[model samples]
Target: MSFLKEISEYKDTIINRLLSDQELCKAVYYADEGFLEKPDIDDLDNLIYENIFPHRFIPDTTETAKTFVTISCTDYRPTGNSFKNGLLNIYMFTHRDLFRTDYGYTRMDFIMTKIEELMNSKRGIGLGELGFGGLNEYVVNEKFQGYVLSYRPVDFNR
Candidate 1:
């Protein structure tokens, strides 16, 4: 199969195998990585879940197209016992045809340690829901390269 088709196939396989909420979230989290050492695959799966199925999830397909990933981070610490929420920064590079993706979230909430570690990491793409306030929401200032990623969220509902 072609590259995009293979990813789509993995997506379907993940959706099929992780039929429960908890299982689904965990599967999605790891699948987001989508690459692993062959012999080490089982070990990685075991580290995440108490089973072997996770090892078979990633497709070690070769890449023919150039690609880059966007880095994202949460805006704050977890509050109360509810699901944690945070803002993410997205970047852009000019391509003749740029594409936007939903990133279909896993309903997978991250603990403070996980959140901090992931946010600090230089690689790996994060998957999360679009927070309730929508893009019409507010954004505080922070530095990015030489420019600031400042923006006023637009409320499409308004």
Candidate 2:
């Protein structure tokens, strides 16, 4: 398979894993404040689904509050003539107010942990097992704060 196809399939896999977890979905709904207006369960699901992006998050001026995730690849290169290696990055963004609670632990901590559980060591079509790389803080537009989790293919020989 082509690299693009592999990436696309992997993205879909990630989305499916995330959406299938009820606990994670509930946390995401609360973090996004979906309960404030008493939205339907379908609405919550739609909101969560819409927030996830394949490559990048297109900024929207009309959105006053948002939480989202972006899946991207970096350092892509051919290895040993037939294999490919790269890093897959998952970025989670949310408003600063929802980023951390007063007790020092952040609200996103559970979300990130859940994602790690779902993705780490997972294998995708045309790719090797994903190994956890690292996690770090990331800020966007002075209003959003979150974490970026990186993963690398274990063998890159698929």
Candidate 3:
């Protein structure tokens, strides 16, 4: 299959799988809000829900039950020959306020940890047939409390 088509399918698999989890659904915004200014922690309760998009923009930000998760499927520059491998970058976004807590672990930590675990676990079940390999790694951003998942589609031939 074409790498582009395979990556899109893999993204669909991820979105569908994550949306199935009730706990994740409550916290996850299912869209990226990179285009807008980050929401103020104080005003997080005032956001509207209609503006969220899969690439950039999540509008709901209610506190205590804030939808702070944005899942974006991004494309990176090909690392080698273009015909064989393709990378997909998935980002998980949350407010920086979620990075620190009385519990010492923080909400972002929990979410990012759980997400990486879930994605890796689902690799052979829900995602395996999509021609995707296991996650390369997940990283936490210093400023945004966002987690990034890097993955590759397997066996794309010219």
RMSD of each: 17.9, 3.6, 9.1
Tens digits of per-residue lDDT, candidate 1, 1-158, equal 33122223332333232332333223323333222111223233333332222222222213211111122233433434533334443221111111212233211212111222223322222223222222221112121111112111111110
Model 3 bad stretches (over 4 Å)? 1-3, 29-53, 56-83, 100-104, 124-143
Overall lDDT per candidate, in order of appearance: 0.25, 0.69, 0.46
Residue by residue across 53-109, what tens digits does model 2's lDDT show?
A: 777674561455666777887787778856776788888877766665443456578
lDDT preference between candidates 1 and 3, better one = 3
lDDT agreement of model 1 with the native: 0.25
Better of 2 and 3 by TM-score: 2
Instruction: Tell me the TM-score of model 1.
Output: 0.21
Ranking by TM-score: 2, 3, 1
Could you tell which candidate, 1 or 2, scores higher by lDDT? 2
Superposed by TM-score, candidate 3 places the C-alpha of residue 62 at a distance from the truth, in angstroms, of 14
Candidate number that wins on TM-score, 1 or 3: 3
Tell me which residue pairs clash in candidate 2: none
Residues 7-81 of candidate 3 have per-residue lDDT tens digits of 456555665555555444434432222212233233222222321133444444443423344345454334457
